[model samples]
Target chain A: MLRVVKPRNARSKRALDAREPKEIEDARIAIFVKGTHTGEVVNNVMKDLMALKRPDAISFSKKNVIHPFDESSPTSGSSSIQSLEFWSAKNDASLFAIGQSTKKRPNGLTFVRMYDGKVLDMVEVGIENFVSMNDIKSAKSTPGHKPLMHFASELFDTHPRFIQLKSMLMSFFNGEEVESICLAGIEHVISVSCAPTPVTLNTASTSADTATSLPKVYIRAYTTKLLSSGTRIPRVELVNMGPSIDLVLRRHRDPDSEMLKQAMRRPKLKKTDVEKGLGKKRKNFEVDEMGDLRGRVHVGKQDLDKLQTRKMKGLKGGAFDGETEEERPTKRIKTS
Target chain B: MDVSSILASHNAKYQLVTVEKETPIEVDAGFLTVTDANSIDEDTFNSNIEEHLQSLARDGVQTLLAKLFSLPTLPSSDGPLAQLPPPTTQLPRSKPLPKIKPLTKWEQFAKAKGIQKKRKDKKVWDEEGQEWVNRWGKDGKNKQVEVQWATEIKLHAAEDHDPRKAARDARKARVVKNEKQRFANTAWAQRAVEAREQRKTEIQRTLAQSRLSTASMGNFDKKLEGEKKLRGIKRKFEPTERSVEQEAKASLALLSRMESDSKKMRKNPTSEKSVLNVRKAVRFASKGEGGVALGRKTAGEKSKKGGKK
Candidate 1:
């Protein structure tokens, strides 16, 4: 799971390094997709979870805080809170986002923040009214469904669904574990008592074809503006960040090409950059008889004498001379 | 010029060359000078020389007497009291006498008191032992056993000095020895014993804990795949007539299904649904759209196309 921290200085524009910031040391969150889910659903959820990597939103020292899925198993054997804690301890993750699918709620995504393997707070975001790639007959037929169908929303504040999703996600920080809220189609929408707004996004009845509803549900998670106070509550807030859909799901003829393009987005260390100033020849290194570092000119008389003897032997052995003449005449000469 | 003059010039040149070179200082005085001076003049030299026989005989007899006198006193020499004449005259020895001596009186006294002077007083009082002891070497044979300062340990004669002693000593040193070797008091001894008992109990407790931990681990004696417990080899091959009939029925059903599928395919070689399905599949397979009718068709169009054909 990609965990991002807020940058400390807003104006500083230096490129990020590989090392994770110490500030985010205690804020790492492990993401797990339930092993029981189908491969396609798990893959989709994982892509969405990784999309939450917004190092710019958080003061993270690392350019990429999220380790790739290949680093650890995406599907854990057990989804129990205790087992999750064990996994978190093993991965050194302070928080965990578990994705589980059930008969009632097929696309359930839960975000939980922890401290020393103890659950500090938790929020469950139900993915609804979103069109999966499977629902569209042919991606090549329509261009509008390409970006809309796949979750790649760069504009969070302007997008209405994004705003609602962010507010709902931030509501989890008001207190500890909250009761699972029930909506028309959603079986649960977790929220604390002191939430900024009501858990139900809309008071009106949800339409039958909620899939075509305005402001689609994009499930992107990110660190939010934490409330700074004298109280004892957790200071960090994990807000729903941005675009929670696979980048390649919009590809027409081939999804693999899109995946490759997405994979290549990572910042690489160019060979030219690495070998820029290493063109000059280095001076010959020498060590003294006492094992101290000294220039070649500082070699003592004894060492010089030994070297001279070796040089003389080398000269006598025809080391410096060209290849020696053959000792024996060839059989052809004997026949002649 | 004569040949001698040429040789003289050559000799002169050789001398000059030798002088120029750095010849060793000691070599000339060591070997060359003696040989050059002793070269005999054979032209004017006396060949026969016989003189002073009487004086030579007397010098020889005097040297023989001196040698006999220098001989060690032998047990059987008492019978030979061969009297020798004293020297006719005393020979004076060479000396560069000192004007005055710088020898101290103390040095003179130390030199006068030799080992013979010390040996004169054999029986002296040993202050530390509070007894009179004969300080002579021979007197040691009669000295008391403990009083003897240089006593040999006789380690080689001891029974423990066998070849196995080294290995046994090593093992003994490694064994958990008594901690009370320092203080023999009862309180310290009790404390040492208690410490040993405590260590023993700690080791036993750790062993027990390890065993219990192993016991608490999951027991994985699961059944192997396709395993039939206690079934003999004979039972594995026991052919039942029922499975044969079941196999024949299954094969017959598969054959009938294949025949029906082939017949239906032959009848609907150009069905409208199949054409539409093929069209939809091809449209899905097509690359990025360029005014192509990709997947937006309906059953009406398919039927119309079929009618036209």
Candidate 2:
């Protein structure tokens, strides 16, 4: 017999089922920059994006791309979803940074991250505060240091969603399902398969004597959902977890500081393999180890003398050379 | 409509018809082919006659028009008198038309003689009175007279004294005579003497070094040179960029010293002292009035200078 099913009342709270943490899928983040900005602005923003230096991050194309954010525009592929799926399958990059610019904010750069064909997080950084490289040069910023975009992480620490976004990137980097906000100063203190990791100070306890210890590094986990607040479409946001750690890692450096100077120093260029193999001495009439005559030709003394005494003009075995010419006495007549 | 009918309807209506009339004329004046005389009614022809006559009468040309137009005569007592009889009254032809006689005998005599009357003189003599009287008695003076008198009182000169000047003189005298004032004034002299001695010693040391360059001499000069190198005081005046904090400290010190000196002397703060106080207060405020924690100073300065690496 079919039993009658009762409707669950909205007032009654449902129990949360204990399920395993969602596994993080390892994928390269494809950076797609689309804007009407000049080459310099685009390049500066790309530098900032690349400065993240996550192992799985790669630009979707070469710098200065003008991809359309509007999916309906022609040449946006047959369908946006199909194109994204195709690119993701081909590049193994389900994550993407869609940088866009609009008329409302001309000097603004917006970075939209997509995970599995859906938008995960977005960050809009305005470039109004950025000083030009020429200005930095004129101001005598330390030698060997080229003024580059350095994001001030402290400015975003107050923002509630920054950490969540940071953790999302981190999870993509490590490819592990982070259940809790487990973090330590530049050290991996927990794993997804392990039992609840015990928290410990990696360097030293927080005290006056240990003030010189390395600063703490933060790890956060994010869960995104469409938070409806009366609009027809809901705003996608990461759920906020209250303040956990006071670790303010110096994410941005002074554009003119000594550390930046060292970072901007170019690697010393050494001679190439071919130049090294060819020694300083001029190899005349000598063959290289590969049996190739790679140097100037040597001239012998006898050859030099013969070439010096060689006659420029005068017929050989002629009247001038003691051989008499035979006389042609009779005129030849035409034969029929 | 057909084309011929349309054209006939729009064509000018001109039909030549001969008129037979017996009149007292050798030949009849032929009318033009486009004459509008027959088309005009008798009422239309005479419509403007009355209006023209009324207009001519309104312009005082009615009699002249009556003769010209040969209009029917009317009775003298009717709408208008006939043009055959002219109006009766004529303007007087007398050389001197009747006019009011001049009131004065002289004016009357002037008119009788036909000589143009002289305009009444602005100034007229009173013949009855032997003396000539002014036409108007004492017309108000045209220009104003500004009368001034010397009323300054000559008083004896009083003693002149300014308290600030007196104080300055007293201070000068004290500095010249009083021991404390002498001591304060002597400070500059002492500084000058010390500076001269130092400069003399420096010159002597340099001279000795120059002389010793020829041969081995005093070893003490070597120690002096080493001390100078260690101190890094090569010149009396050396310019160094002062940090904000150090400048504030120096200003505060100068103001405090000025404050102490004025207090010890029991004098009111002068303009210079007040100016110094303002400067000191500003510096104190910039130093945060001890509200900023000691540890945060470096951090705040670094942030202001563009955040740390």
Q: Report DockQ per prediction, comma-separated.
A: 0.00, 0.00
TM-score, chain B only, every model?
Answer: 0.13, 0.14
Mind giving the per-residue lDDT tens digits that candidate 1 earns over B67-129? 333333323333332222222211111111112322333445677875233435667777767
Question: What lDDT score belongs to each candidate, Candidate 1 first?
Answer: 0.35, 0.35
Q: Chain A structural similarity (TM-score) per candidate?
A: 0.30, 0.32
Candidate 2 displacement at residue A239 in angstroms: 32
Q: What is candidate 2's lDDT per residue for A72-127, written digit by digit as tens?
A: 54644355435444554444454554444446544444444444333334444434
Q: Residue by residue across A1-336, what tens digits does model 1's lDDT show?
A: 234445566332232222222311211434453434423454465453343322211111112222112224345443355555565554555445445555754655555544434444444545543333344333121111101011112222333334333332332211111111111111111111101112233344433213233333322222222233322221222322232231110101111334324322322333442333222333654444665544455564576434433234555865544432232245557878
Candidate 2 ranges with C-alpha deviation above 4 Å: A1-38, A62-71, A74-82, A117-124, A131-336, B1-309
Model 1 CA deviation exceeding 4 Å by range: A1-27, A54-79, A129-336, B1-309
Provide i-RMS per model in Å: 64.1, 61.0
